[model samples]
Target: MQNSKWVDVAIVGAGLAGITCGQTLRQSGYTVAILEKSRGLGGRVATRRLMATCADHGAKFVEPQGEQTQQLIQQLCDRQLLQPWTAPIWTVDAAGTLTPTEPTPRYVAPEGMTAIAKVLAEGLDIRRQQRVVEIKSIDAQTWEFTTDSGEALPLQARSLVLAIPAPQAVPLLEPLVAKGLPTAVLETVRKAMFDPCITAIATYPAEQAAAWHRVGALQPLQHPVLRWVSRESQKRSMPGHEVCVLHSTPAFATQYIDAPTLETAGRAMLQAGAAWFPGMEKPQQLQLHRWRYGFARSPDPMLEPLPHAKTPIPLVITGDWCRGSNLESAVEAGVRAASLLEQWLNSGHD
Candidate 1:
């Protein structure tokens, strides 16, 4: 995008939350621009290509439950970008005993989970890979930003929305905190917690997964290292090949959060997978992804001071953390932020 002097809104982080908020405010007829640090969209709903195969090492599926969320997923389905994924799953107990879980409706994209984000990104002024480093409030209504690149001057916007993780959002809003923001909001930001996860992607031989196709996914037993294991190829119904994504438990991720390398974390999770699937060939390819703020561990709204109204800077900060930690949660948080911003702007109140 060309350097615009100002915009109606300036959003930081182009993840699901940010994108959802963008869609909402756009419908409200507000000109918006988004700044994302990543090369592509979808913060946790990410995928990486492995040789000829691709693995969804981030968010696996979309379980849109509420009315609006259901409508959103239905749109993706009508577009043929997303298809229903009905894969039998098993839940393992603490003692390593496995029990088949009842069937549930799940959805997946043929290309990758990020397709949802791409769909939401249509007709939006999103500036990819622009890492916002600092935010300055010229006044209650005007805010300016500086990016990692020093080549350009500050970009201005009338309002701001933070669609990134809560932990990441808190530090960026520290300036507002020092500006005598509400104590309740400041406490929520300080106390909000996030749980990290290490995702491991491993590809086995073609025929190996089809043989055990009955088991679509695995919520492994009290395995210290592995928490979630699923075959992405099976989910995609791609015919042959077995590409699996393994997620480390919060405890395990925390333990290895400071591990030396990604390979180290990947190896640990891969070895654990070996135990569950015997005769499983050595991985043709293996990779690891670290999400420092993977899951929102914040208290429930009933427990914490998650007032839907009244925030600082006309800068509404939210993510999956305020609500539950899922694709659904992230989208809902974005809606809540947009709604609050709309009311705040309309009332001519701060």
Candidate 2:
């Protein structure tokens, strides 16, 4: 075995949480290395290209609820990366009746939601496409991490933070838990749940798909099949490129997660979306995306320290599911996790 490389902090999962953690630690004058499984960053803040059209497949827009988000939004606005979405949003009932709701200002990344992740990841030592398969306490002051690469070289860190979802993180922390770590932390992690969502992106020829309403997006919450129907093109003022992003309810998505085709997997969602919004027809191009851990279920373990009886390396478990009350909860959890880690690292324990 090769001598493991070491850093001050090692974080897995380069999503919003991981990136935010890396940013926090780096700004605090600590050396942190971020490892991500995917080729690109931004776990849920995703964007895709439907031929020539740009669609936000994961999070459509961010509605800032907390004070932290307000400040972040202002910074994003100053950088010209985010703008307020002033479009009309309506809720369609089961009877196919459109109920226009009051307009609320939401922040949207004009470049794409991934732009936000990119901004947070700037100047951080992020290792993409490297999934840390195993984490073990080598000594009291060191923790070793093994990646999924063919060689599986070991990397060690003085401190570790997990910013991924609970389901994904549970397996990683299982080694520590099985070694007689806190049972409460393990139970809390097991109880963490997230809703599934299947998004269908339908793109049409230029000017072929016309808007039924002047609004930017629509939500068919009462519909049995479709949960949301958004005109992604309208949000960014993409002229001539008509596109719609359809989202299925958690139950429906779970039911059809294994369906064969877009027609079958998203049949109900597509049919209901087209029925509610005019010109939402089967498009010239289409894409299907499945988010098994989409929206997080509320009330999870957050801001708690998982103290090891023997190991000196402290572990902080955090994710969007911590307090899934709102979209900003994940971001909030990320910020808090960093603060906790910094405090722990500066303490006598480490």
Candidate 3:
């Protein structure tokens, strides 16, 4: 490969794992490029803004556990982009009765969940809307990738990494598979399954907001909706005082997996929520978000520590599935991938 245009590494998918890996490699003086198929960043950490109010349509909040995730959260908070929200949580039973639970503070981004991804992508060489169609190794020292737009991007590196989900990564390995890539890797990818979820965000009038809030916590784990109602206005960073977000139960989401439109499903959810609030009126701003690859149900914990090949591919697959479903798990997978890749690059053991 020619030296003029070749990068040291090419990261496919600008999700948490890809962004973290790019950041790590760049800090180590490696020329890296991130290819994101979507127009914006934040694969699962999606946020939507409406009429000056910000609501998280993807990941609602994060519960930090480890030092790395906690540190990341602290840095975001220091930037004045995130805040802690304390609200009584509830679980609805089958009979549609509400039951309040212990109040645990949930942290949310003031600007939105997408703000988190934007923060991470800062100063990184991320090429948005560049969809990588195929990856082929050119000799033992270089790799070439062709985009869906018929553009060729070549990388000359000692290593390469794939930070996308295992299922998404499998199709890209067709060339390697044809050349007889490890069966174990293929099998592991095939065995992984992601659960689906639907999130609904609705904005009611000020007059109706009080009626809904009176219930305190709606639907305490009885219906198809697990977490029934959260006052978006009560959230620290949310701008409006009339918005609310409702997350549907995984079972309900699966049942409606083939729903013709998300708007229909969202409308149905809003109707159900209104039942608990007697005086609740129709919402003005309603949106539905479908997470096709929401979370991992049962995953292989050992996938992260999988051994690399003798002629190691820079490809490393990481996501919430590799560990557990949550913001912390996503960050952990990213940090872990970075650490492992850093060690591999320094080992001199090709």
Candidate 4:
């Protein structure tokens, strides 16, 4: 990107919302740039490879609740990037009793969760490892953004969209907050809470893998330690490898937030799962991932229609915390924010 020229928009946080906003803005003929804090794209939508196996450590699956999201899922399926798994997800109660609840078919990326974000970011101007430290309005028509690396990238546009979480967006908007905006808006942003989660990925020997298969121990709704588990190699477009992924319940994760050793937790989860597969053995390779802000608990209700102020600047905030806690909600929030921005830009108002 040319430093001298100004893009129409600068989107922060290259997660699902940021990427979706960029795609929509670009389609509307706006020159856009995306800044990401991570080394790679996809914030919470992450996937990892262990030895010869691949596993999804974040965002295990997606269920379309609305027509817009359903259409998006159809598009993804048409591209051969996602496939539907059986419905009625299994759940283990606090007493270790397993129950299955059938709902809509849960869809997972064939490769992994990150595959969906990768497909969305295609042909977009994404700058990884560039974390925005500050954002301020230069004037009525220009905005200035500075990265943590001490690089100043000025974006002169009629609108600005913040696709980061509500908690993170609060500090960034301190100046505006200090200016005495309505307490309700600020309170709503502050009230949005995010829950933490832990994912454990394990790999067993070929014989053990076959043994697990026979016992049907890896069913999505059968185990307590695992919210969703799948053979990585069995997925449609996933890399051919033997691996199993496990996601712990939010309640359990809160208990071990400060645990010294993750292995202890992993072992506990493995032991909890042993009842289903009596002969199951310990994994040869084990990995654990902790997510501090895994999902939102109380998301802002106004997320679908982002709030904007005419006096301050054309600043709009959006994220999964604003709408719902899922990939579809994040994308829908982005699209809605983009639409609001388009209207603001055209009307020359807030």
Model 3 lDDT per residue over 1-350, tens place? 55536766777888876787678778887788888888988888887778777777777676676776788788888998878866665666777666776666567776777888888888888878878878776665556778888877644555566767676777877567655456666677677788777888888666666555544445446466545566667664443347777777777788776788887777777777776755333777778888777777646554666323434255566776777766667677777777776776677534
Model 2 is weakest, by summed lDDT over 10 consecutive residues, at 303-312
lDDT values of the candidates?
Answer: 0.76, 0.76, 0.70, 0.70
Task: Order candidates by TM-score, high to low.
Answer: 2, 1, 3, 4
Q: Give residue 293's error in model 4 in angstroms.
A: 1.1
lDDT per residue (tens digit) for residues 1-350 in model 1: 15646877788999888899888898899888898998989899897876665778788887767765687789999999888888878888878787988777788888888888898888888888888877767756666777788544346777788777766766677667666456566566767788889998877777776466667789977778878988887666544567888899888999888878877777778777766775443787777888898888846652222333233357777777777777777788878778877876777655
Q: Per-residue lDDT of 1-350 in model 2, one digit per residue for the tens?
A: 36766778888888787788788889999888888888888889899865554789988898778875777788789999998887778887767677888877688887888888898899998888888788777656777777776455457788888878788877877778655467767677777778888999887665755546555677876555677878776678677667788888888888877666656766566666777565555676778898888888776344344322324367777776775635476677777778887787788554
Candidate 2 vs 4: which has more TM-score: 2
The candidate that achieves the highest TM-score relative to the unseen native structure: 2
2 or 3: which has the higher lDDT?
Answer: 2
Q: lDDT tens string, model 4, 25-132?
A: 889988888878888777788988656546677876767768766877888899988888653344555565656655567787867778888888888888788778
lDDT of 4: 0.70
Model 2 / residue 44 / CA error / Å: 1.1
Error of 4 at 78 (Å): 1.6
Checking candidate 4 for backbone clashes, the offending pairs are: 88-102, 90-221
**Strongest candidate by lDDT:** 1
Look at candidate 4 and tell me the lDDT of residue 176.
62
Residue ranges of candidate 1 with Cα displaced over 4 Å: 1-3, 150-154, 237-240, 279-281, 302-312
